[model samples]
Target: MDSFPLGVAPHSAVTIRFVEALPDPSPVIAEIIGGGRSPGRADRYCAGPWGLTVVVGLAADATPAQAAKAGALAAAALIGEAIEEAVCAIALSTEASVAFARAFRARLFRPLSLKRAPRAEDLCRLGALTLVAAKPKDAARAWAPWQAIAEGTEWARSLCAEPGNRLNPTTFARILGGLGDLGVEVEVLDAAAMAREGLNLHLAVGRGSATPPCVVVLRWRGGENDAAPSLLVGKGITFDAGGICLKRAAHMEDMRGDMAGAAAVAGAIRALALLKSPVNVTAVLALAENMPGSRAQRPGDVWLGHAGKTVEVIDTDAEGRLVLADALSWGCATQKPRQVAALSTLTYAIMAALGSHYAGLFATDDNLASALLSSGEASGDRLWRMPFTPADDPALKSEIADLRNCPPVGPPDAMNAAGFLRVFVPEDIPFAHLDIAAMTLKAEADDTLPAGPTGFGVACLVLWLMAKG
Candidate 1:
């Protein structure tokens, strides 16, 4: 069997041994399997001679998603045991190999070790991941796409792992600005520029914070210069303190991950540029920090957005749509894209509806919605389409403004939030809103994700962009 090196490094090193119905088995492996269970199960055993061995079984006809999840679970199982060498392999095809590589590397991601440690092991460790490929051609074919996925997923997760103190608006723009090195053009419009350009609603959300807000524009021109690209607008609330309407004392720290959507957008464009895909893509990240201060907008306040529409703030915490509304209008007017997709951890109502199993997708047209759902299935980051229009719930209407940020009374808030955003997107352009509330952070380790932030939409967006190919 030939071993191929996955281009990316994992946080922890782990050795995964792939075995089939081969007759020549080592004595230790044989002994362990003698008492082990069936296929698709992963078990770790301590052999007196071989040290720690993680044995993962693969079915003959496993799909790419199954193979990917199995690889992640197996890699995670080996991390705590401190086994580093060769990772999991099953002589996978190019697609399965790419899937396995993306999930395995994501599972190895952990919080960065910022503080100095007395021991080497105390810091986060990066190890090699070796995948078994049947032929050199297959390995070469899978290399670039796998690297793209790994880089994108890890980038988003690392951003999520950052603390709010270190990742405010200015610093966030600086970090995204570095994407220029990857051959993407990055431009950041500061508060003064945004205010001059009539992004008042975006600015109002950050009024309480000393760190000024900004809009980050990233352009990757892999297609023709005149070709129309798809625009991705992300709500980049670096920290959500729930503004004047404070959140519960408990679990408020989870707000540090409020920027996962922005991270994922940048990451997806990073992948597109890295892969040199034949598609143009534009990303507009609405960066801010929602904090409580004397200057912050209170409930029932109205602010005009870039689209020349006034939004009434029913709850200060419903700031995602506020930022997104302005960003969407600004991006559509400036970039002139064929379609729009906005990603945000916008509502708790989404989690209440779909839980963490899927992200809520609301689109203007059935064809666009079906395409995104297909991409989600192909990528393993599933999306559930919501049958919601602004007219579905009349409560989203505002008494004093053109739009209401949230409904004051009973209704599905997630649907209403997406419905509110529908006004910003033009009828000529197809629009999809991804409400990724429940899918961003995972409370426990799973088959395809670690115990923290899962880079949920990176895969979905990548697949969707490349689907035309």
Candidate 2:
């Protein structure tokens, strides 16, 4: 793992000036500001002496969260690209100023780099940033939580961005083992162990790839010894070639990000552990690779899942849920958690429905759904609730099996996928499914997030767990 240079530093690095509202600027600052009208939010300028100056406009009607997000956006725009040091100069009430500074620092952080070659000059070598605040102590205190969340987000992004060849099931499990250093109890169940436990559904998905299948469980027991931990399951298909039902060539490269859900789960656990939050959390990652070799599971096949339910594979493209079935069942049955949440890039149908702005959230428990929704709103990993009515169940029914992997024909494909997963979890346990196919990757650059992996669920999940405590 590459080291991340994050935190407050002494006053020797480059300066990043952040203004809540622009005042009469000096001649040099004016030249950098240009003649363009200020949009009054997340405006950027390059003053020679200031290095990178960011002006964050806090509208009278804007909430503190919005103002903080704007500050983060402005700071994020300057991350990477060889800036040695930065100073955030913000003038607001001590409370608001501290919040803005913490958010800014979080955004300015960059994740682990995959670049192989050494550059002539350091690229993206930002060493440190100093926060100039009236209340330095308060700002320092606020920085801790945001720093943990940012590190988790960056970890997820780096994992998702890694190529399939480098991050196969074994390697991914190995990488996750490092979390044990942070006091997270780690367990890796290999293919032989899964077979012994009758995880045929998960094994079938990885039959085509030499990487094999595994379940990586991370346990963080920061709360009471006997507390029923909250469970998080992730679909970790490292690369999805759609198995026998192959995908088109146009965007096939993007399939490398199929394991984003697992990455998010891993990231969330890391954040909670780093913060030492007073809550017990467990993450079960179902790791696999879906390819189109002769041994791969094909359409029209039937497989018994970990829950002892039979599923008919109608389309090999819908493989994520098959692996998830095993992980969710195994986690819920063995651990017997109080609540469970699973994340997956399960369906393009979700992307078609919600686009890139929101992930589709389906939960059996209303309170769990509401808590996640509130967390999403607060963390900027927004989710839109999708109905999980009995009406959607008919699409999952099959003549020969308990459920069909994909609907024969339906407009609510996303809901149908959720409906299929709903069968695996017992009704007594509170469960929520997040179809994050849209949130895994981005097509356009935003103020805070760049054009690639967004690491969407890490912050939201961590915040929700923190709220539970």
Candidate 3:
């Protein structure tokens, strides 16, 4: 759990400038484009001869959101593969300029590299980028919150990107323990400890994995009073081999990202702690590794969860909900939180329905759901609320068990998975389930993000927490 520097600290690898309009093109840019004029809004140009590459042009009519996204796009164009020193020139208001710079720095950030051998050019890199505002002094204050959010997001992405061998359930717990430095109280519940408390469903899911399963509880008490904290439960399947219902060979390699939800929870808490937000929050990360072995839970097996609810396992591949059920129930019953929100890459149905553009959100409380939606929009971690009705519950009913992990026949499978988890959440508490199957990773580099873990929920959760404050 090596600590990486937070945000894009001032250095010499990259340079970014925000302006109302593009500056005069560099001689090299001019030569490359045959002495053409500067680029228009949302356009960029690279000048290698000037020892710099720059992204130019931001539309005058662009909204603050668009400007932020443009800034990310610009920065993404220059990180890693491109020249280390880069500039972002935009013509906008001081506030908009600050917003652009914040986003540019966030997108330009790279997580700690685990590469054992690296090129000499990449060794001892000290690249830094600057954000020049129309009013530099005023804009300086505006970058703080965004910088904190970026640090948290990058931290989560680094954890998610770590190899399974390096970041198992035990190592994950150890890594989160680092947050104790920020006043976050960290607790780890091992397999025997959880079993003693009747967390059968959660433990059963990881029975086959040598890495074992655990529950990580991170408590951040920054509020004034002892009111109930907001409880966040994350599914931390460090690696998913699909158990006995093994997945096809096509993209099984990506299973390492199954723990992305836990990473998001950790990231959100880190951001809140770094910002010193006056909100009490508890994050319950249900960590496990779903692998195929003689000890693995088989299909049709039934296990009682922490809440004394029985879940019949219909498909071993749908193991996230099993782990989350125990965490949600345990968090609610023990912590007595005012609200509960669970994040997980729980269902492929979500990806099939919403694609990579949005996460599927299912909530029992309208206000909480609305707040999350608003946060998602503002944070660029978009969520589409999926329909959930009493009608969807019938699919989860089982003849022997209280509920089935996956119904042989159901309303869209994602909703069924949500329905299964809903049974674990107490009716009196507000609960929201975020199925981020499509939001975890990208197939290709986009304007604002690289082709890897996106750290989608960190900013959204932080914004929601801030709004609550």
Best by lDDT: 3
Pairs clashing within candidate 3? 12-128, 13-127, 13-128, 19-90, 19-91, 20-91, 20-92, 21-91
lDDT of 2 by residue, 1-469 (tens): 2242221111112223333333333554455446563544455555655566655556434455765776677666555444666554444444555456546654554433444564422134555655544555665666667678877877888788777777789889998999999999999999999999889999999988878989999999999999999999999999999899898999888898999999999999999999999999999999999999879998889999889999999888889999999998989999989999999998888887788889999999999999999999888789999987474466778899988888766564888888888888989999999999988886655665555677889989999999984
TM-score, per-candidate, Cα-based: 0.89, 0.87, 0.89
lDDT for model 1, on a 0 to 1 scale?
Answer: 0.79
User: Model 1, which residues run further than 4 Å from truth?
Assistant: 1-28, 34-43, 46-51, 59-62, 80-83, 87-89, 114-126, 391-393
Give the Cα error of residue 184 in candidate 3, in Å: 0.4
Candidate structures ordered by TM-score, highest first: 1, 3, 2
User: What residue pairs are clashing in model 2?
Assistant: 14-85, 16-87, 81-124
Decoy 3 TM-score against native? 0.89
Residue 459 alpha-carbon offset, candidate 1, angstroms: 0.9
Residue 106, model 3, lDDT: 62
lDDT of 1 by residue, 39-157 (tens): 34565554534355566676535567776787787667665455455444356665666666666777766644454332343333436566655553665565667577667877888
What TM-score would you give candidate 2 relative to the actual structure? 0.87
Worst ten-residue run, lDDT, model 3? 5-14
lDDT of 3 by residue, 1-469 (tens): 4453322222122334333334554465555456554554234454454355554556645567777777777665555443444444434556676667667766665544544565542332325555445655566566667777877888888777777777789888988999999999999999999999899999999998988899999999989677789999999999999999898988888898999999999999999999999999999999999999889999989998899888899889999989999999999999989999999999988988899889999999999999999999988899999976474467778889988888775444888788888888889999999999889987666677656778889999999998984
